[model samples]
Target: MSVKYAKRMDYIKGSAIRELLKLTEQPEIISFAGGLPAPELFPIEEMKEVCVRVLDTDGKAALQYSPTEGYMPLRKIIAERMKKSGVEISPEHILITSGSQQGLDFCGKVFLDEGDTVICESPSYLGALNAFKSYLPKFVEVEMDKDGMKMDELEKALQANPNAKFIYTIPDFQNPSGITMSVERRKKLVELAVKYNVPVVEDNPYGELRFEGERLPAIKHFDTEGMVIFLGTFSKIFSPGLRVGWVAASPEIVRKYVLVKQGADLQSNSMAQREAAAFVQMFDLDAHINKIIEVYRKRRDLMIETMEKEFPEGFTFTYPNGGLFTWVEMPEGVDAAEVLKKALEEKVAFVPGGSFYPNGGNENHCRLNYSCMPEDKIVEGITRLGKVFKKL
Candidate 1:
C-alpha cells in the first residue's frame, strides 16, 4: 500500500547532528556532535528532593493539567530574571514551553508564512533552522564576523528584505560558531531591527553559561517597543530531561503563543514544571550554575589546547570565552561532511558546519562540543581527528 504524508513533511529532514548522534551510540565513538550539557553536572540529588516534595505536598496540582500559559510560579521567576537582564517583562508576558525548541516552533507558527523572508546569522543554530523549516520560510543568511553578526551586512539584509518577518539570532556564545556578539554589535542589532520594523527572535539558551567574559546585555534588553521575542531555557543550566523553557514577548504575541501552546500539547508537563519551580526556589541555582561553569570552563580550555596542538596547520577554530561549542574551519575545498565520515570511522564524531547553515554552504567547517565529554576524551578525540586531517 502506498502511504501519503503532508506536503510540509517533505521539507523536514532528519537532523545531521541527530544522525551523527546515532553513530556515536557505538561504545568506541567519542562524540563532539551534540550541543548537550554535561550530565555529570546535573543536580540529581537536588532534583530528586524537589520531585519528592512536589509529589508529597502538591500531588494534585503537579499531576493535573496546567494552563497553556504555563506554571505561574515558573513564569514569574523567568520574568524576574529577564528584569535583571534589563528587559522589564512580567509573568503576563511570558509563556512556558516544553523547551526553547518549542518556543521556536511557536514563533514560527505565529510569525512566519510560507515564502516569508527570515534572516539569520550565517551558520546559525540547526535546531532553529529545523524548527523554521516546517513553515517553509525563505531563509536569507547574514554574514558573521569574529565579534558576531556584521552590523553593516545586517542593515543591508534588512534593507533588501524590507518585509523580513523576523531576524533570529543567538547572540551569546552562538551554537556551532560559539561566537559571542559584542555589546556594540548587540546595540547595533537592536537599532537595525527597530529601523527596519522587523522583530528579532533572540534565542539565548547559553547566556547563563558564560565562564570568563564580560556580560553583554541581550538585544531584548534594548527593545522598548516589544520588537524582540526572547527565548530562554533551563536545559543548559539545570537539566534537559526536565524539558523546561520560557518565552518573553509582547502581550499580544504571548497570547497567540498561548493559543498555539494549547493546540500543541495542552501544556508542558505540570510535574516537571512544579519540580523546576521547586528546584529554582528551594535550591541555590546560581551556585549550581557556577559549578557547571567551572566544569565547562576547564573542558573548554582542554579542548582548545588539544585543538591547537593536534589539528592540522591550516585548521582554524573559534576561541570562545564561554560556550559548549568551538567551530573548526578547514582549509578551502575540504568537505566537512566527508571528513565527518572519516571521523566516524576513527570513532570520533562532530557535526559538519553545513548542517548549521540554511543552504549547506560551509563545506570546510564543523562544530565541536566540549561540555559533554570528559577532558581525556576531548584530547583523545582531537588526536584521532588530527590523524584524519593528516590523511586529508
Candidate 2:
C-alpha cells in the first residue's frame, strides 16, 4: 500500500523507548522508562520572565535566523563551562546542535560511509545506535563491565576492524547502565584511541548531575592529540524542552559539523537558544543544578532501598553515585521484556536493556530512571516491579 521509499528506511525502526512511553502515559502508571527530568523542577517562572525580557529587549533578532554555529554569547558561555571538566576550548571549537543526539547523527554523516564500521559500548545508548544505523554502517559493540567499556575488548575490536570510523562512548554515568569510567581506564582509553589512530566521541550529557562522590574530568581532558570529540547538553541540567546541546572538537571538525548542520535543519531553534543564553547570563546554573541534585539523590536512594528490600534472589542492580538511572539484570534465562509486560499490567514501566545494543542478545536486563518520579512513586513502582520479578 506504500509508495517507494529510500533503501535506508529499511534499516530504521521506531524508538523502543518512545513506543513504551505511549503505553506508560496513563496517570496510574509509574514509569521509569524515559530519561525525563521531573516537571516539578523545571524553572517555569524563570523561563516565562526570560521570554518576556527577551521580547522587550530585542524581539526581532531573538526570533530571527541565527548563525549555524550557534549564538555567540551562548557559545562563549559553553566554552567557559568546559574548563570545569578540565577542557580548555574557545567558542570557535564548538558547534551548537539541536541536542547531543544530533551530534551523534552528524558523526555518522561526517565519518561513516556505507559498510564502514562503527564501535560502541555493547549496551550503548539506543538512540545513538538508531542514529548510526540509518547510514548503513556495520556496528562493532565492545563488551562492558562496571567501569565503563572494557579497554581490552575495545582495542581488540579496533585492531580487528581497522576500518572503524570512530569509537562512541558515554564515559560518565552511562545511559541504561549508570556506570562511570574509572580514571585509570579513562587515561588508558585515550591512549588506546591514540594508539589505534581512531577518534573518540565522548558524549557527556549526565556528568553534571552527580549526587555524591568526585566528578571526574571528561575523557576529552586526557586527549592531547585532539582525537576526542566532546558533546555537552543543557537538557539534563536545565530543560530538555529547550533542546540546546553542543559539540566541542578541533575548529576544522567543528566547521564540517556546522556545514552538515546547515543541510540538516538550517540551525536549531533560534528563540530557544537566546532564551537559554539569556538565562545563563542572568541566573546561577550551578545553584539550580544543586537543587536538582538534592531531589534526585534522595530519589535514587529510595529506589535502591526499596528494590533491596523487595526484590527476590537472582535480581541485582546498580547503585549509582549520580545520574537518573539504575540498571537491573535478571537471571540468565529470564527475559526482561516479558517481565516488563507483566510490570506494565501492574502499571509500572522501564526500558529493556536488549534494545540498547546494536547487535542485540542480552534480554535479561532493564534500566530504571529515578529523576522523573517522586519518592513515594519510586518506592511504589519498584515494589510493584519487584512483585512482578518474583512471579517471573
Candidate 3:
C-alpha cells in the first residue's frame, strides 16, 4: 500500500550547509565549513573522571527517566550563569534540551505558525533558518551594518511587519559574520522589541568564547517584561557531543517549553547532565575557555593574515573580536557558490554565504571557520582558496 506524508514535508529542503559539510570529508579537502570547536581542546581526562564519578555515585538515576524540565542541579547552575549575564532567572524558568538546535526547534514549535512573520538579520545563521523554516514562517530580513543590524532598517521592517511574532538575533559575535552588536545597538534593539511588543529570541551559544574584548550585557539583561527567550548551550564551552543546552525564559513561557519537551524527548541525556554538573563543579570552566580563546585567537589571526596577503585587492573580510567564523565578501558580480566549487576543486571548502540568508541570495559572500583548523592548515586552505579566486 502507498502511504501519504504531510504536505509540510514537501516545503522542507535539505540543509545547504549540511550538504556542503558532507563534501568536506575527503582527506584532500581543507575544510573551513563547520562551526565546530577544536576537538583537541575537549578535556577528555576530566570528562573521564566525571563519567566514572557519575556511574559510581548515581548510575541508576543517570540512566533512568528524568523530569522534562531537566536535571535540577544543572538547571540551578544554568540559573546561576544567567545571573552573571544580568538575567535573573531560576531553575523553574529553565528547560534543558538535547542541544541548542533542539531549543531552536522548540522555539519554532511554540511560537511560530504557518504564514506568521519572523524577522532575522540578513545573512543570519543557516541552522536557525533551517529549523524555523519547517514551520513555514515568512522570514523578514533586516540589513546589518558593521556595528550590527541597521537600526533604521530594523525600525522600518518592524513597522512594515507589525504582525511579526519575534525577532531572532545572535547579538554577540554572530555566526557567519562574526560581528558583535555594539552596546548602543543592543540597547536600541531591546528598546525596539519592547516598543513593538514583540518577543526576541536571543541565541547566545558563542558569547562566552570571547578572546579579546569586554563582555557586553545580553539583550536578555534588558528584558524587564519577560519578552526575550534566551538560549544557551554547553556545547561550545564544553562538549558538543554531550548535546546539552538550556532555555531561559519567563516562568510562564518556560512552563510551555516543559510540556513541549515532554512530548519531544521527555528529558535531555541524564548522564550528560550529571557529568556536565561535575565538570562545572570540579574543573575551572573559565580557565578551559581561556585556553580555547587562545587557540582560536591565534587561528583567527592566521586566517586573517593569509587572506590579506593572498586574496585579491577588492575582496573584504570581517575582523571579528571573537567567534568561530570570518565572513568574506567577494567583489560584486562574483558568485560565492561558484568560488566554493572552484575552491573545492582545489581541495578546499567553505560555506557559501548564500545559504546563510533567508532568501538564499547573497552571491558575493561566504563564511570560513578558523576555530577547527590548525594555523598551518588555515594558511594552506586560504592559499588554495586564493588561487581559486585569482583564477576566477
Question: How would you encode candidate 2's per-residue C-alpha lDDT over 258-301 as one tens digit per residue?
Answer: 99999999998888888998898878889999999999999998
In candidate 3 the C-alpha lDDT for residue 38 amounts to 95
Clashes of each: 0, 0, 0
> TM-score of every model?
0.98, 0.98, 0.98
TM-score of 2: 0.98
Segments of candidate 1 deviating more than 4 angstroms: none
Better of 1 and 3 by lDDT: 1
Candidate 1's C-alpha lDDT? 0.90
Q: Give lDDT: candidate 1, residue 126.
A: 91
Clashing pairs in 3: none
Q: Which segments of model 2 are wrong by more than 4 Å?
A: none
The CA lDDT of each predicted structure is 0.90, 0.91, 0.89
lDDT of 1 by residue, 47-129 (tens): 78998999999999999987888889988888877765678888989889999999999889998888888999999999899
- Which whole-number lDDT from 0 to 100 does residue 223 have in model 2? 90
